[model samples]
Target chain A: MRVVVPVSGSDPKTRLASVLTPDERRDFTDAMLADVLDALTGAGLEPAVVSTAPVDCDAPVTVDERGLDALVNDLLASTVDEAGGALAIVMADLPLATPESVDRLVSTDGDVVLAPGLGGGTNAFVCRHPDFRVDYHGASIRDHRRIARDAGVDLSEVDSRRLATDIDEPSDLAEVLLHGDGAAADWLADAGFEVALTDGRVAAVRK
Target chain B: MRVVVPVSGSDPKTRLASVLTPDERRDFTDAMLADVLDALTGAGLEPAVVSTAPVDCDAPVTVDERGLDALVNDLLASTVDEAGGALAIVMADLPLATPESVDRLVSTDGDVVLAPGLGGGTNAFVCRHPDFRVDYHGASIRDHRRIARDAGVDLSEVDSRRLATDIDEPSDLAEVLLHGDGAAADWLADAGFEVALTDGRVAAVRK
Candidate 1:
């Protein structure tokens, strides 16, 4: 399977602006990308890092300035045609992703296997059958279901908390600090980000 | 309007098990209940704390010893019938709720005004129409919408971050710490619950 880990190199994790500086966001994004790449590699799959701009990471980087939905759709079409097998796309914000989780995605038997995000977004997906295009619109998970049904392709859904918990909003940073010990976690630790009692409530802050 | 603040007194916030002890949970629940009551009272509404077990808070406690859906449904049914006006049910976990937000719920013109939680739950709601009822099952917000449509009553959705922010999981403690200066935030602060970096990731922990 040809796996693509998409990262936002230009400006990433904008939702975390409340808790992270712009540079911190980029660094955190790279750290999460590293974690995803490590998991994909540990699963015995060679993955490529696709980003909007050039990102400094260990993996082979492919910079494509296209919008998320269009870029991934194009990548899937070309890769599946050439490889004639499974092609997977994973979001880079999944700091809690593990080798076993990646293995689950590839091992699931279906034309399309999806790991749905908490807000009904498709976090990671494997497209095995030909003619199954991708769409990341509003409520894309629900849209994916309809697209799969119309295409008459089997769709397998993977319900994993680690995969579902993508680090998007500032509130999500708590999950990584609590449950993860990955490169992203290390980056966050180095950056002095922690869950702290700020003015009497629970919050993630740099302390 | 009779405002009912529903709380799970027996085992509240099971999702926060990783961070809070049982006693801490009880205390935090009471603190949040106090915040909700303060908001309701500030809005000139007589609020009652409805719980499965007896709870000590700022409001009058009404122990029903029933499941959440059953108790809230019963309260809404009886209150709507008796008052011949609007009746509201607000979750006890909304420490960030303000008098302004509660007033928005009561003042909204609709048969049923729902304040949807981040997770598909109804955090706060106003039932004005005679036939309008509530269902707090799994994904109950969507169920309530269907119920309203079936009953042919207009449904108003109040989208407020304060109303949407309900402290459920350990990660949720961050919101209260970040934006809340309420009793719940004070309780969390006193309990030593803070967002901190533990071993690399961000987590809400007692130091």
Candidate 2:
């Protein structure tokens, strides 16, 4: 199966802007991209980076400046059209993603296999059926399921906590710092991020 | 509207056993119960505690040894049977629930109003329609919606992140430690719990 890792190298991770500067965001995004690439490679599947701009990673990179839906949908359609095989699109911010989880998603038997992120987003997906397309709109997990059902394709969901946990809001950094020892975790540790109890709750912040 | 806060004073929060002792669990449960009581009381409605054991709180306490679903369902059936008025059932672990969120739930016009928990559980609900009952089984939120639809009732959902965040798992303690300032949060803080970056994710622990 061909894997596509969509990374917004240009001004990525704006949600974490409150906690990290623009340079820090770029560094964090690169760390997450490296972690994702390592996981994909460890699974023995060749991954190609689909980015908005050029990114330095140890993978074959493809720069497509189109919108998320258009870029992924076009890639899915053409990948299946030319080779007539399976394709998977994985998000680049899953710092906790593991090789085993990626392998589970790829090996799952379904016309459309989806890995749902928290709050109704698609973290990763494996498309085998010809009519299966990608949609990253609001609540796109539900939207994609409906789309597959309407298209008469079998849909399967990967129940993985590692794949579900993506680095988004600052609070999500807690997951990486606590459960991850990957490139992202190493970067966060070096950046002086620590989990502290702020105002009676757990927050990731630096002194 | 009469509000019923269901609590298992017998052995509450067994899921937190890994992080808290039995006695600590009881204390934490009481603190969360108290926080929920304050939220209910601030909503201008006198609430009652439907508990398995005697609990000290500002509201009236009723000792009901019945099972969770049976007790809440009976309360819903009898409340509508006796007064033909609305009854709301709020969970005892919603330490972050505010007065405005509770008020939003009660004031919402619906035959059945449901507050969905992060998981597939019903956290809080208002039963005004005669046929509306309670179900706390697996995936009860989805089940309740289907029940309300089958009964020809207008079902409204309360979309409050505060109300949805309940203290169940140890990881959930991160939420309380991060966003809560109630008795439960204070209890957790005074107990020396802090959010720590462990194993690449955020977790609550004390050294």
Candidate 3:
């Protein structure tokens, strides 16, 4: 009934140096965490965003007092102690990730449900019980799946495109520009961020 | 066969600000531009990378030494005067953009070939004559298409997936990391740029 979204504001692999100014990158991950919280709250779920990195938010969400991974484990532990039953750990970068997908991921009858990334790594994991401890950093998707198999948890894959996509690179942002239209797109237009997404600029700046 | 690639590097959108580090954004765009140049050169075309915004490059690309719009205009003039033929103005953020697609854009017989973006913006434009100037920026895709219509030049539409996608937001980057592979994918991975591109991190980030 509770979801823990632990965000490590650092993804050295999917950094946004080219498209984002320094300040933009600094605040982006936190905002995304907020958005995920929004999505969860909208879906009538109690959402807790555990920030691995420092962030300030006016949202009614709870920030973990522990490290990101540790906070996630604690959330699971607390959930078990309180008979919370089910817990979901969601990543924040999936812009298209929807609440319906999260519900499906959590509702699946598995001791642990692994929502794998498009690359074969898991993006999210739902644990029915807190007896299993997990290591969720460094190719965490693969690691979690292995753990799920080892624990003999009934594992299910939710092939939701919305839940699968997480933005980290410049080109990935372009895809949202191409398909998404909303406050995010309008904000992009207003921010003069189109240069990185425009084709003319793309062709001109080739190596 | 002088090609004009109008390049612009813009700040990251507020929404994606949370998901990307500044370096990741820069590296993603830089790698995309590099790929665009490689495709152009590999296709045996002379590329004049007109950096619409001021920038430095690691390649022997021509930085539009003048102002962004002016430099594009000058490049257009020079190419028109030299070749006495058509010139192509392509965008730069398309990381997966291919030379074959570029060739297709150029191969079309028309006073202008407009390759529309997914958002109905023009990604690639081929000007058949020197006198017909493209707006080159802003809602120029529609403007260029209208210009082609007025010029009575055969307006050709090449709907290329590679050409259509541009990174305008953080979510867009997620789509790229989800679908893109090969050099751009490898470069993103090697550079430690993680955007979920695959079903997993594209496992869509490192895969």
Candidate 4:
């Protein structure tokens, strides 16, 4: 099984712009990537980083400038040519992910295993069937299920909070500060970001 | 099609005891139940509450003191006798659930449509196949998948944060106050519980 962690090296986590500067977002993205790599390595999987631009990490980084959908679909197609090989794609923004959750996701038996993110995104997936490909656009989890169904393959899902909680909006930073215990959490804390309540809502605020 | 929201009417939300008193826990449970009921009704489905004890709500309440697995299994069996009928079970503690998410859960096509909760519980499910029974023991979502596979039925999952985020621990209260807009959120505010950062972690603290 080849595990791949896809990241956007440039201008990532734009939704967090209100709280994080561009440089901070880039640094925070690296921190999240490091956390993901640590979890994958902890799960005993040697993962490769596939990013839109150059990134510095412990794992081997492949700078694929293509879009997410194209990059992932191409990776899936190449795996199909390998004849009986599995590919696992995990997004890099899941700061709360632990080794056990990633292990459950990969060890599950199915033609395709999907770990759906919050608000209908495919955070991570394991594709064992050659006919299976990915489409990470517009409710991608639902689309993946339909794609697997159309290909006449059995699909399974790993329902995990750690894998589902991708860092997207500014509001999502609170989850990292609360449940995360990785480099991303350390980065946020070092950057003077902490969870705070303002006007009946909990969010990550800079002091 | 029939919709059921199963709630534990006696000493519910025990995990919340650290922050809420016994009476407060009961009241908070009722508020969460009302939120679930409102979401169901808003989705154009008239739902019934099957509880362990008497409860007050807008929907009809049926007190079934049996365990969760037995109660849900019996409900599935009863639905089998209805001849091509479907049953949807949504947990009462999912205060973040919205009407649109519930609508998607039921409207989706599958023998068993599961909305898995965080930490391996099945928060909500729609069963169209008669042979499918539930076991709400350890890792209920995985058990349900195996059960569906053993029965030779297609299982689909709704990977929704709203349905997945069940209010269990005191930390979960922040989610209700953040993303929730129902009676449960109102109850938390009325009870003087607000989101606060304590010891670098976010939690629902009493003001």
Return the top candidate by TM-score. 4
**lDDT: worst 10-residue window of model 2 chain A:** A195-204
Q: Is the docking of candidate 2 incorrect, acceptable, medium or high quality?
A: incorrect
Instruction: Order the candidate numbers by lDDT, best to worst.
Output: 4, 2, 1, 3
Query: Ranking under TM-score, best-scoring first?
Result: 4, 2, 1, 3
Q: Estimate how well candidate 2 is docked, as a DockQ score.
A: 0.03
Highest-scoring model, DockQ: 3
B52-164 per-residue lDDT for model 3 (tens digits): 34555544455454554576566667767566866777777776576676776778787667776644466777776765666756555656767767867677666455676
Ranked by DockQ, top first: 3, 4, 2, 1
The second chain of candidate 4 has a TM-score of: 0.96
Best-performing candidate as measured by lDDT: 4
Q: Interface RMSD for every prediction, one decimal?
A: 13.4, 13.0, 8.9, 11.7
Candidate 4, residues B2-66: lDDT per residue as tens digits? 89999999999888888999999999999999999988998999999999999999999999999
Tens-digit lDDT string for candidate 3 (A6-101):
666444223677766676665555555555665566667776666545566534445455665677677778785467577877877665555565
Per-model DockQ against the true two-chain complex: 0.03, 0.03, 0.07, 0.06
lDDT of 3: 0.60
lDDT of 2 by residue, B59-165 (tens): 88989899998998888778876779788999999998878779888998898998876545678999899887767765566679889998898998765556777
- Candidate 2 Cα outliers beyond 4 Å, as residue runs: A198-201, B1-207
Give a tens-digit lDDT track for model 1, residues A3-108.
Answer: 8888888878787888888998888888898888888898998999888899988789988888888997787778776667678999898887888778877897
